[model samples]
Target: MSMRDQAVVVGASGIVGQAVLRAFAETPGWDAVGVSRRLPVNVPLHARHVSVDLTDRDACASVFGAMKDATHLVYAAVNEKPGLVAGWVDRDQMQLNLGMLRNVLEPLQANARGLRHVTLMQGGKAYGIHLDPNLAVPARERWPRHPHDNFYWLQEDYLRERQPHSGWHWTVLRPRLVFGDGLGSNMNPLPAIGVYAALQKARGLPLCYPGGPPRVYQAVDADLIGRACVWAARSIEARNEIFNLANGDEFVWQNVWPVIADAFGMAVGEPQQQHLAETMPPLEAQWAKIVGQHGLQAPPRFREFVGQGFAYADFQLNTGKTGPQPPSLVSTIKIRKAGFTDCMDTEDMLRRWIQRYQELRWLPPRDG
Candidate 1:
């Protein structure tokens, strides 16, 4: 990796994608370029930004064509919107991802001079959703793909099929819930939960846990994921492997609930007997209105609003492998071992997310 051996990040405008771009820019040997449907807000001054429709084969081809010198590719682009979750939504998030992969890989296979590796960000849903009670707690990469997880399975299949035949190294990173600078993110459960909890507290509403009783919930900073991506792209050990990345520590809902409540200044209250669907009907309605008002594009139906209030409920991750050792107990561990030692204070991260939500008018300021 050298200044001349640039790295191209697709979906550079997204939460994970942007973090990946930032990581590439900070790494010593590589220049970073971001390709997306639109130019990302506040792109780093050093990285190049190219706007292109990833769904269009020609457009994707052209973007990669212009990056002829790129030695690494990080596929981070994703269409964000929760409404596409239904089985028949036809948005095809998986297909779109596959198209981008082919568009980049095909050209690289043909013309790249020093193309060495590619890292694609994926999720835990590939293992299965709504895990059975008998299944082990803290799912591992070795777990077979859940038969029902079409999105993850499709993208993963594409990666597995292409890696050996294309002659380039590949790594798939499955990171459970990621939280970081809250400004432009849509998938993170933290920002929404922080905002919802803050608003509920401000309004004197009870704190609600939407999913199954408190299990373990894990998260990693987006930047950490980015660093891991860069490390994987540069290290031969990372090639053709799958890693589960998350905060090294796992906390039961009992633990995380208090942290969020304290950070948002919410009253320490017990879960309401009311189901989330009932208590938060208004919130759901409001979210729909907000989506319509902002004209934000929708994601695959499978992803639509599925994790809303339940972000902290049933989601648990085993971060011992992907996060830090001695276990920061709050941040990702595997990534730490992968050479990313930075950690974002969990409380601080929560507070900042709350503040950003208020600043963006997504949530209102507390009136003492």
Candidate 2:
């Protein structure tokens, strides 16, 4: 709570972590650093960058030892395997993710005497949203844990059991679908949607809805998640609590399809089974052509830039082969009642981020 508090954001290159970095940079008297195996080329000048694999304990100790003055830690890093959903129940994935946090926290706890608060990012998956078709609507923080080998349970348990009794407090955030403009983020849906739209428009085709059955969903803007991180670290009421966050509204993709098509000046198409992992690899040449025609500055291998992000979008829209089920929602009342009232218009948030991708040449501009 001191004005000169310093914070370190693990997984700094990730969507949530990057947002945390920006939030800390904007604070009146906070100094922040981002930690990841690789640093983004365009990290904000006001922040410091540290490159160290959180899975490597000695490396973590070497890098974090210098941050004895750090007062806050935001752990937003994740280890995602090839199939995003399938990896949810994979024990190896769980161990890898748990190890990443342990490597960082063990070192920081030993070295940072000023460490006061720690924040962790969990998701709707914590409520069995990924593996259970019958997940209770409006998932709440107090719900009983679904019996699964989920890394969230492991990580949260570790944090609660390991935090030093006298110094630090911990909080967890469970956001549904997180949307942002991070190009290389394995979980970002924006570039996946953006590139898919650009490709469809380039081929004189409708901007199709590529995913599973039509079901309702919710999303939290990355910036909003970042704000919640800052608030949780600084507020007495938020400490030792887990809260669900979204844009404060729920939406069905079918209803928003037209809005997206219009944003790109394209026609809307019916929802279809489009597997991005199977489909995107074949579209690289076409993406290259679009890049050349538009003088865009995207990676020559578009698939590399977008990576598994598109697959994540596809999985999110239509929950794989299980067909449609009830809407997946998370109650945000806990965070709201606690006084972090920031909300985002989901449609507008998508539109703004898509336009930003165009301006940055990460995606082509809307074609006529």
Candidate 3:
């Protein structure tokens, strides 16, 4: 009989959840089950996929209740209202996210008697970055919670309230500007950047810096966060704690523009400050032709492929201001001190993931 422990990852179609799914799938002694309402383009081949609506309590109970072997849970799912960034502060969005967490946990707790650890995903939103762009440099996990209406707090509170009575412990990870492979993810910018570059190349134009004034920021490789989730699941130090995650470095968008341009086989051009959300959709026919010409695997229809990513990319890049903005840096010292000390250069990480998407056939190959 196979004795591998079960690792069930919810929101398995998201960038964050995909990373977690791969980590658990690749690791020894763990069987990975990915749960998502939508199927991701690149689910790990070793993992099993579960399709169930997390918003429906009965469905989650029916689904999770039968999984008596689930030993670890990674909750990376979130529901955001339409128009992307504007939904960050929406109260209904907050409640929907909270309820989804409740739906999964209540049944999982009742059925998965042997569940040992749970990992929850949060982001810079916990520090008021979504509401106020001028968050202080190097946000720390030690700081008192910011005054806000974030669903992160709601879900965290739910975990806190239940852990004292439950057999399993929980960990929360807050990562900055996550980048990885999840098609139609609400926020990964890879698809947006890839499509933008391809369209520009198709038009014989340079890859313009299509963003606003320069702003410094940090990013975490989704896979790195995934490994950390595995680390937290096994480490006693991670129990009932929160940690901030990053790529251990920082970069400005325009500063890295040349790297991005070269990746797409294009030269850097003038900063165009184009609103990707406003501009990219109208070029779907152009994208369709590029898809067939390059044998790209992404859906030809832009919305099916990108979801809110164009709008998300616009919000991330086109800040529409003339002055310097504060960088959303977060300290990873706590996690390192706790013993998971993995690190990578932000520029190298970007190059690697861009190449990965190309290899995955989600983007066109850089022409010779």
Candidate 4:
């Protein structure tokens, strides 16, 4: 009820959640609780970590029973059943994602007496980006929710309905293609691109633009999203509103592909329209060999090493099916007007995170 001092980040291991944890560490007087199924190895020391399966209602209640001091909740967790993008419309995806949020929100709403704000994460799909590429360009937060079986709608509707009764205010942030540093983050595109480039260079192949057609694109840096979440919680103007979050810049694969290639010290191949899911599977053994040869961080399995981020990145980069449709973009004017003015250069954000992967040995060092 008093100005927020304690924040509970429900999906601490996720790209957005991890950024929230790190951001909270730098903000004075804010203690945080990080909730997730598994604790991330790199979580900030100032925050407390709780490993409670959010899908289990009793488990969630038990965890929050002791969190009465929590004044804010950031729900960044998502439940995407198998097949990634295909699961977007699956009934199970909707049920499971809605249920995960319910398990956490119900218990906290009942128990956390000081809770004042909630931040929920959504993505470009709300504008029908996954359903059809041509529906709209430069998606605005004011657009009607695209007709689809999306959990974003379900969760957002739930939040809006509860606002009058519940003491906490809420904000929904829709980001496109979040790029960040982390293993096991479902939507992180950096490690996937980092690994793909390293492997392709090893085989004496140029780093190719794997997706189809030149299309304009935008992305949100995980750190910026984290900051936005924090700002939304504290900014009175951000309450009960939806904001499209991005780096405030646009890019095309045809132009940035060569830059990515040069970062790995590989030649830039012609844009041939390849799918990484098809091409990267067979190279697992080769990745293992590279790990051994370079003494890189050897993950137990390649998939876990990069998480579903590999397939998700491929799904994101492929402009092939989009036809002559104009590029997908999201306007951030709403958030800027609300007074959160953070921005990042899209290309620099991607390249910087890839460099971080190399420094951490999560991906092999780029070739000289």
Compute each candidate's TM-score over C-alphas.
0.74, 0.95, 0.97, 0.95
Which of candidates 1 and 3 is the stronger one according to TM-score?
A: 3
Q: RMSD of model 1, in Å? A: 6.9
Candidate 3 lDDT by residue in tens digits, 1-368? 33678899999999999899999999988899999998866778899998999988899999999888999999999997889888988899899999999999889989885988889999888999877877777888989999988899999999999999688999999988988988888799989889999899998999998888888888889999899998999899999999999888888999998998888789999888878888888999999999998888888987777889998998888546667777767889999999999988888888898899889888998872
Q: In model 3, which runs have C-alpha deviations exceeding 4 angstroms?
A: none
lDDT of 4 by residue, 239-295 (tens): 999999999899887788777776677788876676776777778888888788777
**Candidate 3's TM-score:** 0.97
Each prediction's Cα lDDT score?
Answer: 0.60, 0.83, 0.89, 0.81
Model 4 stretches astray by more than 4 angstroms: 1-4, 298-300, 319-323
Better of 2 and 3 by lDDT: 3
lDDT of 4 at 196: 82
Query: How do all the candidates rank in terms of lDDT, highest first?
Result: 3, 2, 4, 1
Best by TM-score: 3
The local lDDT score (0 to 100) that residue 141 gets in candidate 4 is 89
Error of 4 at 35 (Å): 1.0
